[model samples]
Structure formats: structure tokens, C-alpha cells
Target chain A: MGAGLTLRLRNELSEIRRLTAALDAFAEDEAIPSDVAMRMALVLDELLTNTIEYGYPDEVPGEIGIEAKRDGDMLMISVTDDARPFDPRKAPRPDLEQSVEDRRVGGLGLHLINTMADVDYARINGRNLVTLRLLVTSDGDGDPVAVAT
Target chain B: MSDAGNQVQATIGSEWVDDVLVLKPSGRVDSNNAGSAEAMILGQVDGGAQRIVLDMAELDYVSSAGLRVLLVTAKRLRQTGGRMALCQLRPNVHEVLEVSGFLAILTVCDGREAAIGEVTKT
Candidate 1:
């Protein structure tokens, strides 16, 4: 498997299916575990869905970019979109343990992404950029490289 | 139509057995079609079907958008004195539910028979 892969898709919800398939083939070639790959897919899917669904003001033509690479046993992933300058990392955490009646439906996506992966976000040059890193090794015995925003 | 993203277009099937409503949602449920999944389930709830069972044996993937649908549907059913049970989650979907602490709140069974029993039990 190559050390890096870049994917560009239009800012549309339909693009997520393509994204997941590419991720699946990459994970298979790289020999990443199914569980780990699913986690990675989950976080990225949530973030990208948010960007595609709510990022733009209308059906304006735009693009989102994803770059994933393996650094040692860690998987480094970054997603960039030229939508609104929103920072997902700073989003408020949802109450996970709240009673079902009191719980809200929509906020869990960001919460799940934050819980499953180490994420950092930045708005640079009028773009929304989010970076995520995951430990792909089963032993879970490596120090995570800090991503500077 | 095939999606460039390799996601199968989501499809939802429903059946009624006795007093329970059973939903079979196949393919990926993400932002693209979670609304359809939610609408199907909530529509049953709105139609006064109390006991609900989701047969997820063929469900290959689920994202946070999908999870939200399940949570919201479960909550809505509970408010109306209805019960919802899920069965046959794929490994990936199971893991997502587990990591999100959904196992604690949702009634999940090992198979369709168990799910039907759980939801239909007195």
C-alpha cells in the first residue's frame, strides 16, 4: 500500500459512499484491522457528512479533500473543505448519559467523532481543515504524534 | 444508481408480525439516507405500532447519522409506551453502538427470534 492517498469529492452527501469505498480498499491493502478501519471510517464519515450537508449555503459547487497516510503504526488523516470557517474541535460536547427523553438527536455525530479519534481543527485561508490520527496497531503501545493546528 | 463512494443506496423494508413492527434496513446509513430510515421507523410509530424490532443482519455500515436515527426512534417509542429491539448488527455497526454507549440504552438481541421475543414479551 502506498504511504499516502488523496481523494477529492464534490461538496455533496452522495460523495461519502465513494469516500468509504476508497477507505475500505486502502485499509485492506494496508492490513488495518476491520474494527480499527471502521472507527476511522466512522469519524471521517461524520465530519465529512457535516461539511457536505451544512457547510455550504446552497447547492453551490465546491470540493472537499481527504488525505490519509500511514506513519509507522499510526494513521494520519486530514479533511479540507472551503465551506464556512467552522472549527469542529471547539464544538460543545453532548450529554451522552442523559435520559433518552432529554437527549437530543443531532449532536451525537461530533461527539462520536471526538470520542473515537484525536482530532484538531483550524480555519486557514478561508477553509475548514480537520486533522485526525488513530493508532492502527492492535497492542496500542505507541505515543500519538501531536498534530499542531 | 451506484455511488462513486461505493456506498449502496440505502433501502428500508418493513413487515408486521402480530403486534410488532419489524424493519429491515440494508446497505449503509449515513447522512445520505438516514432521514429515510428515520422516517420509515417514525412513521410506524406515528401509525400506532407499539412493539418495534429492527433486523440488521444485512446492515453493512452505520455512521453517527444512523446512530442518531436509532436513538431518536427509540426515545420516541419509549415516550409512547412502545418497545424497540434491534438484532443481527454487523461487527462494525455493533462496535459503533458499543463505543457510543448505545448498548446500555438500546435493547439489542443476538438474532431476529430473540429480538421479536424481547419486543413482544409481556
Candidate 2:
């Protein structure tokens, strides 16, 4: 597994894509389905976008390290960011059932991430670590198709 | 950021064929400078280029900010009883539009000719 990505919001978007592609390549090597790989990419993009937007809003440079490994049937994608320790699990989930006008905008990113992946959160050594586990199945039979990330 | 030195570029070309206004856009549109792109296209609408056909054949990527501008443009055109169509979207951008539900709302065509035909037929 490779180590960190220096946190610069401007270039983080492309880095997220790069990391996702690397993980997808790994998944393909393991014979993971194409559909599942695409979903994982979308989830990772939304999560990284959130970290760039909210995690370090002040634009203070930080580092985001993405590590991926296969654990049984699940592909674990962990993102570690050295920003202010804020647990996304504690953040209020958006009310998806509500009308768009009534619903809040900011929480949708986290809500999508939680709904799409098996999310685990922790604050380790002054860094926020978010682990997202996606089940790789030949047959698509897990969670419902989430709102676009 | 100065708009002049910015790398983001947008060109809007309009032509009327059978009462349909076709607007072709080329280059990137992102957070850095979607304002000019928005203004150029929306300005055409303001200048009586109704029933607009947006040829996104050359467009590479569009960020959320760019998407927002498109949404506003669509809403405005809808209110005025004018139509807007997007044609020949790149694969990556098509995915973004699909995910955002813009595919459901916007009229997407296979090519510029098809888009023009659709707008004129309606």
C-alpha cells in the first residue's frame, strides 16, 4: 500500500481521481465487477470533495492519505487527512426524503458517503480517518442505488 | 483571479436553421471561470437566441459550479417557453450529467444535427 497525498485543495480533486483509478485497477486485477468499481469511484470522489471543502476550510495545507486493501469480500478504502479532527459519523445526516428546497445542502455529501459504503470513522493522532468498505460482488445485490455522489 | 489570463475558455457560436437557435460551446468550464461561459451562453438567450441547442461535443469537463450555471440557464429558458438541448456529450461529462439527474431533465441528442432537428420539430 502506498502512503500520503499532501493536502492542497486545488489539486485534491485530480488526486482523488488518481487514487480511485489505482484502487479500481487493483479491483480489476482481483476480478471485481466493472459496475462496482465505478460506484466506488463516485463514493471516493464525494468523500474527498467533502474533505477538501469542509475538513480544511481555512485552506491551511494538510495531507490526505488513501490506503486500500482487500479484507475478505470487501474492498476497504481508507482516507486519512491531517485536518482538524472532525468525525463525519457525528455529523447530522441529511433528510433525503424531504423536498430539495427543504433539505439542507452541506450534509448531502456525508449522507451519500454513508449510504453508499460501510463507513467507519475515527480520530487517530490528530487526524481524521475515514474508512469506507465496499462489498465487491459479481451480482449487484447490496445497497440501493444511492443519489449521485 | 483575472479572467484574461485564465486558462478556462468558452466560445459560443449561434446559427438559426429552421427557427432553432444552436449554440456550440468548446473548452473547459469549471469553478475557476465558469462565469464567462455562463455569461456567453446566457447572453445569447438574452439577445433573442431562443430554442438554444448546446453542442457540448468539445466540452471536456464541467464542475458542480458549472452545473449550477446550466441549471439556472435551463430554468430561465423553461420559463420563457424556449427550449435548450445538449448534444454529443463526452463520456465523463455524460456520467456527471447522469448522476446529477440532468440527463432526465435536459434534452440530449447524439449530434448537433439531431439536436437542431429535435428543437425545430417541437
Q: For this target, which candidate reaches the highest TM-score against the unseen true structure?
A: 1
Put down candidate 2 lDDT per residue, A21-134, tens digits, no spaces: 575577666666655665566567667766765666463666777776666677777888887777767768544454323433344445546665888899888878888888
Which lDDT tens digits does candidate 2 get at residues B17-90? 76677766665465445567788778877887678888887775555556756777887776677778889887
- Using all chains and alpha carbons, the TM-scores for the candidates as numbered come to 0.87, 0.60
What lDDT score goes with residue B30 in model 1? Answer: 85
| CA lDDT for candidate 1 | 0.83
Could you tell me which 10 consecutive residues in candidate 2 chain A have the lowest summed lDDT? A2-11
Candidate 1: tens digits of C-alpha lDDT, residues A1-149? 67677999988778887898999888877888777888888888889888776788775778899999888789999999899887887779877677678777777778778888898888889888899999886532112335799
Candidate 2, position B120, lDDT? 71
Q: Lowest-scoring 10 consecutive residues by lDDT in candidate 2 chain B?
A: B1-10
Clashing pairs in 2: A7-A62
Candidate 1 per-residue lDDT over residues B47-103, each given as its tens digit:
998998999987878888889899889888888999999998877788778777788
lDDT over C-alpha atoms for residue A4 of model 1:
74
